[model samples]
Target: MRVVMFGYQTWGHRTLQALLDSEHDVVLVVTHPRSEHAYEKIWSDSVADLATEHGIPVLIRNRPDDDELLQHLKDADPDIIVANNWRTWIPPHIFNLPRHGTLNIHDSLLPKYAGFSPLIWALINNEPEVGVTAHLMDDELDAGDIVLQQAIPVSPTDTATDLFHRTVDLITPVTTGALALIAAGHTQFTRQDRTQATFFHKRSAEDIRINWDWPAHDLERLIRAQSHPYPAAYTFHKGNRLEILAATVSQNRYGGTPGRIFYRENDGIVIVTGHDARTGNNHGLALTRVRTHTGQELPATEYFTTMGGYLTRRP
Candidate 1:
């Protein structure tokens, strides 16, 4: 079958690679252009680069609704349109072009965590599992009927990066399987239950701010979730922004203001986190590794010789 693939970022790059490896002919690839900014880190292997390497026609456009792009799609006459990590809203005319319509690959299980940065969000929330969802594209964002979904357990020690690689490894199988199902005249789709639907907003600079008032366990989860590759969870120490690389829930109970450092040791920096309602006292979050604004990564012991200062809160 002739296929038109729309994708961006690392997820898109991997999906396109899988499609190229499969039996179907990829007629064209649509991907967003690299940003012109110097400081912005490109997290994924470039989809456009990958497509170009395979000698496939690549369209670098931000909006899929452009008249020229739509005309190009019509000219290609694709049997199916496969989308993965393609940001921006794809208009119905564009999505409905192919004979089999558009199928999308989403990072999370649909009806939950249906927006950006899904893996990071899942880790922060302490979700038990995370996986991919290949579904038929409808008018609603990620509300499409599910063609296939397979979950993997979220390990306690799994960071966002760890889960990302695990999920990426599954995309080839899931995508190929979904395509196989569609090609075999199996067009059935399981309707998602609307009652349990949840959508999250795109992450921002503000989302990485570590709130000391949160419970110790949640804070520990946040640190691991946002650790390296993604932005590290941070708080202001002295006059500089301090990025926390690793942390754990401190067993010791302490009494102090939520943001204040209550105890310091070579192993960890035990700071008061939140009020423990059961004990009517404050709990602790221990920071094991951190990097200061000076670009120096160090253990908690080296970072702080003296404690008992309140961490600055910034919006």
Candidate 2:
């Protein structure tokens, strides 16, 4: 089969590599230019570079809505289009161009997380498993018929970064396997249950801010969700931004206002948390490691020499 790929970052890079390795002919590639967005910078393997290395035709577009791009797609005359980690919405004409149509590979299970930063959102919400989905593209974004899905169990200690490496490894196999199925004239695709679907927005600095009013378990998961290589979950300490690198739910309960720097247990500093913390039945967040505004990382014990103040949502 002749293929055209639309992708960006490592996710796209891997999928393109799979196509290059397969029996399929990769005729053209479309990808986004380099980005400075916080999340966009991570997991960024260059799709354009890989395509160029293989001598395949490459087009860089922030969007696929332009006339020249549309003409190029018609010229390429591919049997199918494969997309992964594509940043913008693709118009119907573009997605519906090829005979087999567009196959989109997403990083989460469909009918649940259908949009951006899915692994991070799933971790913060404590989903039991996370995986990848390859589905036929339709008019709606990520709301299409499913072709293939592969999932991995989410361990209690898993971070977003951890799950990222695991799920990304699925793209190659999922992309190739889905293409093989399509080439064999398999058309019985699974329809997504829109009633069970969820969509997410891009992550920003505001999304990583730590809120002490949340339960300690949830806050702990938030720290893990935005763990290193991505932005660390953060709070304000003494008018400075303090990023939490590692944390856990405290072993003991304490009674105080949310955000209070209350106690030291083992190697961590316990920050009182939860709306009901004052009732003395709630566990606090035990921050184990942190980074100061100066970029110096430290153990939470050393950072809080005297624990009597507060970690605030704002300065």
Candidate 3:
């Protein structure tokens, strides 16, 4: 099938690579405009570069509502459109251009995490399983009919980056299979249950802030969810922001104040969380890896050496 691809970020890059490896002919590629000034540029390959290498046209538009985009779609005349992690909402006119219509590959199981940062949100919420869904695109965001889906296990130690990689690996095969089935008219899509749909907002800096009042297990999940590629969970310490990269639920059951930096331990610095006020569980989470403001990530042990004198329990 003649396919037009739309995507950005690492997940998008993976989808583009998978399509290139498959039998489908990608007619055009659309991606967000590259930002040179962002502190951490997430997009790895220039979709334009991949398109040019394959002799496919490329469109770089920040917003899908632009009139030029509509004209570009009209010119390419694709048989099918595949969108992966596309940041912008595709206008209805463009979605209806292709004969087979547009398909979206979202990183989460739809009718659940339907909006931005599904993987991150799932981890933050302590979901044991995360999956990907390839669905027919509609005017609403991720509110479309499902064609294919595959679930992946989320380990207690899995970070957002880890979950993302696992999800991409699982989805590649599902996506390829779904596309072939759709092109061959062997598949029937089903509309999603709108009542079960839930949307999540983009993760902001504030979202990454560590709230010690939360349960130790919940705090641990939050730490793992935001670890590595997604900005680590952070908290203010000694008037400086500290990003916590790795943590473990402590076996100790001392009923200490939440956010209290306890004495340094063998593995790293131990921190206490609020006694689950509801359940009365006293065990708290511990930080194993961390970074001080404007500093590179360091083992919690190494970081505590220089700053340990200033560390005090959070009030």
Each prediction's whole-model lDDT (CA) = 0.86, 0.95, 0.79
The residue-by-residue lDDT of candidate 3 on 1-315, one tens digit each, is 888999886667778888999999888899887765231264355666777788877888888887877888888888889988787788888887899898899999888999888888898788889999999898889998898989988887888888877887865787787898798985478889999999998777778788788777888888888766566778877788888888888776545466666656558676767645334367767678888889788888877654223333241
Candidate 2 similarity to native, TM-score: 0.99
- Judge candidate 3 at residue 30 and give its lDDT: 92
Q: What is the lDDT of residue 112 in candidate 3?
A: 93
lDDT (10s digit) by residue, model 2, range 60-121: 99999999999999999999999999999999998999999999999999989988999999
Ranking by TM-score: 2, 1, 3
TM-scores for every candidate against the unseen true structure: 0.95, 0.99, 0.89
Output the better candidate (1/3) by lDDT. Answer: 1
lDDT of 1: 0.86
Mind giving the per-residue lDDT tens digits that candidate 1 earns over 1-315? 899999988899889999999999999999987764221244668988988888999999988878889888999999999999888899999888898999999989888989788988999999999999999999999999999998899988999889988999889999999999999999778999978788887777788898888888888989888867777889998768998999887776776678787687448999788744245375688889989888899998788889878776662
Choose 1 or 2, whichever is better by TM-score: 2
